[model samples]
Every structure is written in structure tokens, then in C-alpha cells.
Target: MENNSIWVGKLKKLEPSDYTMSILPKLRIHEENVMEFLRLSASKPEHITEILKMENNSILIGKVNNLIFSDYAVGILPRLGIHGENEMEELGLLAEHFEYISEILRMENNSIRVGKMRSLVLGEHAVEIFPKLKICEEGGIEEFFMVTDNPENITEIFRTENKNISVWIRKAKKLRLENCAMQIFHNLKFQKENVIAEICLSADCPYHITEMFKMENKSIQIGKVKRLELNCYAI
Candidate 1:
């Protein structure tokens, strides 16, 4: 698409006028699998939308694996000259999947309201833009993500009781902080004993756990050395 010659060549071959036969069927369903290739192959081929809208009830359908609207459709909307916050609102009415729009925004390293970031099975990087994001108000921390790069978010989730207490327990163990993990375990409203034992086994520090045993053995050995010194001094 960067090359003007290739752009001219494709248009000359399809001749814009012949797009009905040459292009329209490719967008028939949500795969956009076809259009993904087509759009990147050509630059600013906005007329593709015209071909799509020409069909009966131009409203888009949700994809097979998707919870709501088609991700592929939301992605191409921007290329069709639909962009920005207000544009999102316009498309929001038609969209079955709001998460896909959030994903598109994430791809661009952009942010949106936490309400729009719902059904967030993906887009981990996008949600990192808060306290700008009101995730707790929308649902809770667990509603958005699981593993995060930020430790602050981990503490925030625990503080809000946004998930099962065991989640925070596991996270604290993962961070390898024994004292904090112990405190979190004590605070849990309900506890899973098996899971707690598993975390302790995984988190055990051999040196710290055996410190008193090691010191007692060293003192007994030190008494034998003191007896030897006394015997030499008497000789």
C-alpha cells in the first residue's frame, strides 16, 4: 500500500466500478479474514464500506468465538475514516463486542472509559492507564484482568476485595514476600486450607525456617572447642 504503483495497478485491475464482483463477497461474514488482506494490500480503499452497506440490513453480526460484536469489523471502521471517542459512540450502537473496540484502542496505545473496557478477556496493556480507569466502579479488578505488570494494582485489588481472597494469597506468594503473604492469609474471610498449605510449601525458605536448629548445633560444637582450649592451657 505504501507503493503508489501497486495501488494504481490494483485499482486498474479491479477498476473500482467492478468492486461488486471483484470485492464485496470478501466481507460477507465476520472473518474479515479476507478484508484484512484486502485493506492492507491497498491504501484508503474507503469504497469497501459502500459495497458492504449495499446489502440488506447493514447491521454487523457478532463473530463465532466473540461474546458480542465482530472485532474485525470494529478494527476496519477506523480505516474507513471512523475514529475517535464520538465515532466509538456511533459504532457502539452497532457493535456486539465493546472489548474489541478497547483492543483496537490498545493496539494504538490509546485509552477509553472503563465502562467501554468490559468483557476484558484481553487488552491487558489497555487497562493499565488507571486510576484513570474506573474498573472497581464498573465491576471490580478481577472483571478486567489477572496477571498484571504493576504491583500497585495487585494491592489495589486485594484492598477492594475484588476477588476470592486466595487470589491475593497466591499473588503475594508469587511476589516471595513471606510476612505480607502471612498477613493476607490471616485476613481472608474464608480460607482454603489445601491451597494455603500448597502456597507455604512453594514459598518456604529453608535457611530462615532452620535458623534456630542451625544455631543450636553450632553452640554444641562450640562447647567441644572450649574444652579443647582449656586442656591445652592446663598442659
Candidate 2:
């Protein structure tokens, strides 16, 4: 019988074990079908990894595999609680799926931490609807400091009093920052130096504020200590 006909017949069998051992072999005879099966079985992490190692580069094979793997990783892996000590292993398998799916989906947003597979599906539609969704920064202290006090702007919020700025800065290094300016200042003295002067002296200045100074050079003193203090209070 033809491979297609064989696959059709196997699909009719309705048994996963039978499908795994019997139909899978025949379906894999063609690179395209093999890719398809690999994708459909993406929740089966071991199988998907094996398929990724295949040499075939056919567009259909790649596309279907990607779709299947993405769906399985993002959609299926989070729900499994298998028998025996394999439960955590199963979740680990799903985590690997999320990692691979994120890469295949060309997602650059490190903000969506994939400790589990469920988050994959959570963001899948957003990515499809807006490919730019992946460009968004993961939330952090800098983000919090940017748009706080606006009820509509808050999504996730964390606050710590007297937290060291350096510690937060270190944590931010592990996250993605999309088009945000970052700077650290040392030895800033409010008694003598103006806020504007301190900012001007700093190597890295916020872009928008710097632009305002450029457009109105005389209005903004380059190194006036008193003016800088007032501006700091306003912020």
C-alpha cells in the first residue's frame, strides 16, 4: 500500500501505542510526513528533539514541525502529571519544548520566563497577533520606575524599601530592556550640585531630558547646582 494510504489507515486505528510503533515508522518514510508526526507529537519531547536532528530542510517539513512543536510545547506540556518519578521529568520535557518553541517562534522577549510549558500557549496568540510582542521588555525596577502611579499602566508590581540600587541593577542585567536608558551615578551631593548639573556630569544621561536641554540650552544651566536640586524634587 502507498505511504499516504498506510498513514490514513493508521490514523483510523485510534491507538496511541499502535500509532507510535506502527504508523510512525511508515509515516517517517517521507521527510515531510516525518516532520508532521514529530510536530503533532511535540508534547513527546524526546521525539521532537530527534526530529530536529534530521537533515531535511523542506519548507513544508519545517513549517509543520514548527507549528506542531509550538502548539504542543505551548499548549500541551503544562498539563501532564504522569505516573511514577517521571512526573518532574515530564515537566522538564515540557520546559525544553517551551525553550525550543520560543526559539522557533523567533521570540526575543526574555520577560516570558518558561519555567513551565503553559506559558507558551499563553503568549502564542499575542505573538501571532503582534510579532512585535516579542520585542517588549520584561518587567523590572526600571520599568516600574517609569510608569508607576498610572493605574492603567501597571501590570505586575514589586516594591522594596531601602533596597540597594546596585542590587536591582544586577537583577536587571538578567532581563531584557527594550529601548530604555539606564545609568548609575556615584558621589552625588544634593547640597552643592544642581540636579541638572549632576545629570550633565554623568556619562550616561536620559535621552528625552538631554534633548530638552539641547533645544533650550540657555534656559537650562549646564552645571547649576541649585537648579539640579529643584529638578530632582520635581521628578
Question: What is each predicted model's overall lDDT from 0 to 1?
Answer: 0.26, 0.25
Cα lDDT of model 1 by residue, 1-235, tens digit: 1211121211111112223322433333332211111221212234244433443223222121112112233333322311111111111212223343343444321122323222233222222222222222322222222222322322433445344433423322112223112223333343333222112211233332232333333232111111121111111
- Local error of candidate 1 at 4, Å? 27
Worst 10 residues of 1 by lDDT: 82-91
Off by over 4 Å in 2: 1-39, 56-97, 105-235
Number of backbone collisions per candidate: 3, 6
Reference-based TM-score, model 2: 0.22
TM-score of 1: 0.22
